[model samples]
Target: MEKKLNHLLADLVVEYHKLQSFHWYLKGYHFFDDHAKLEEYYDAIAEAVDTVAEDMLMLGFKPESTMKGFLSISSIEEAKNQEVTSVEAYEAVLADFKYLLDEVKGVKAAADESGDYLTSTKMDDYIEFFSKAIWMVGQEVR
Candidate 1:
C-alpha cells in the first residue's frame, strides 16, 4: 500500500508539472481563459501532491520527490517538445484527470483492503475533486 501511495504521489507530482507545461505552452482560442484554467488545475494538483507526501510521511514512507523517480512510477507521460493548442491541452489534461481518478480509486480499494480508512477517505476527496475537474475540462474541450 505504501508503494502504491508513493507511486501515486510521484505521478501526481509529474502531473502537477505537466499542468505547468500546459499553462506555458497552450495557445490559440481561449488563451487567457485556458491559461487561467491551467493555473487553477496546477494549483490544486500542487496541494494534492503535498497532501499525498504528508500522508506518506504519516505512514513513515519516504515520498519519492524527483523527476527521475516520478518518471519511473508515473502512468502518465510527460509532454516533451510537443506544441499543442488550448483544445489539445484541455484534452490531454482531461484524459490525465480521468487516469488520475482511476488510480485514486484503485488506491482507495487497497486502503480499504488494509483497513486504512483515513487513506480511503483521502482518496474520496480526490475522486470528488478530479471527477468535477474531468467534467469541467470535458466541457471546455467540447
Candidate 2:
C-alpha cells in the first residue's frame, strides 16, 4: 500500500508539472480555454500531491518529495517541450488522466486487500476526479 501510494504521489507530481508546462506554453486557438483548464488541472493535482504525502505520513511511510525522486518512480514522462498545441496538450493530459485513474484503482484495490479502509476510501475522490477529467478532456481531444 505504501509503495502504491508513493508511486501515486510521484505520478501526481509529474502530472502537476506537465499541466504547468501546458498552461504556460500552449498556443493557437482555444488557448484561453486550454490555459484555464490546465490551471484547474495543476491546482487539483497540487491538492492531491499534498493529500497523498500526508496520507503516507499517517500510514507511517515517508512520501517521496524531491523532483528526482518523483521522476525516478513516476511512469508519466515529463513534457517533451515547453511549447505545445492545444491538441497536443489535451492528448497528453487525457493520457495522463487515464494512467492515473488506473494507478488509483490499483491503489484502492491494494488498500482494500490490506484492510486499509481509510486509504481505500481516500482513493474514491481521485477516481471520480480522474474519470471526470478523462471525459471532459476526451471531448477536447476528439
Candidate 3:
C-alpha cells in the first residue's frame, strides 16, 4: 500500500509538471483552447498531489515530495523541450492519463483488499476524474 501510494504521488507530481510544460509549450491552431484546458488539468493535478501527500502523512508514511524523488519513481515520462502540435500534446496527455487510470485502479483494489476504505474511496474519486478527463481529452487526440 505504501509503495502504491508513493508511486501514485510521484506520478501525480510528474504529470503535473508535464501538464505545465504542455500548457507552456503548446502551439498551433488549438493553442488558446489547449492552453487553458492544460492549465485546468494541471491545477487539478496539483491538488491531487497535495491530497495524496496529506493522505500519506495521515497514514503515518512520509510522502516523496521532491522532484528527484518523483522523477525516480514516476512511470510517466517528462515532457520534452521539442516543439509539438496540439494534437500531439493532447495525445500524450491522454496516454498518460490512461496509464495512470489503470495504476489508480490497481491502487484502489489493493486498498480495498487491505481494508483501507479511506484510501479506496479517495482512489474512486480519482478514477472518476481520470475517466472523464480521458473522455474529454480523447476527443481532441486525433
Rate residue 108 of model 3 by lDDT.
97
Candidate 2 displacement at residue 111 in angstroms: 0.3
**What's the best-to-worst order under TM-score?**
2, 3, 1
Residue pairs with clashing backbones, model 3: none
Better of 1 and 3 by lDDT: 3
Check candidate 1 and list the clashing pairs. none
Error of 3 at 72 (Å): 1.0
**TM-score per candidate:** 0.95, 0.97, 0.97
TM-score of 2: 0.97
**Can you write out model 2's per-residue Cα lDDT over 29-78, one digit (the tens) per residue?**
99988899899999999999999899889989989989999999999989
Summarize candidate 1's per-residue lDDT along 49-140 as a digit string, tens digits.
99989988888789898888889988888876666788888888989999999999999999999998878999999999999999988887
Residue-level lDDT of model 3, residues 1-142, one tens digit each, is 8889999999999999999998888889878888999999999999999998999899988898788988999999999987778898888999999999999999999999999888999999999999999999988865
Name the better of 1 and 2 by TM-score: 2
- Residue 82 alpha-carbon offset, candidate 3, angstroms: 2.8
lDDT-wise, the better of 1 and 2 is: 2
TM-score of 3: 0.97
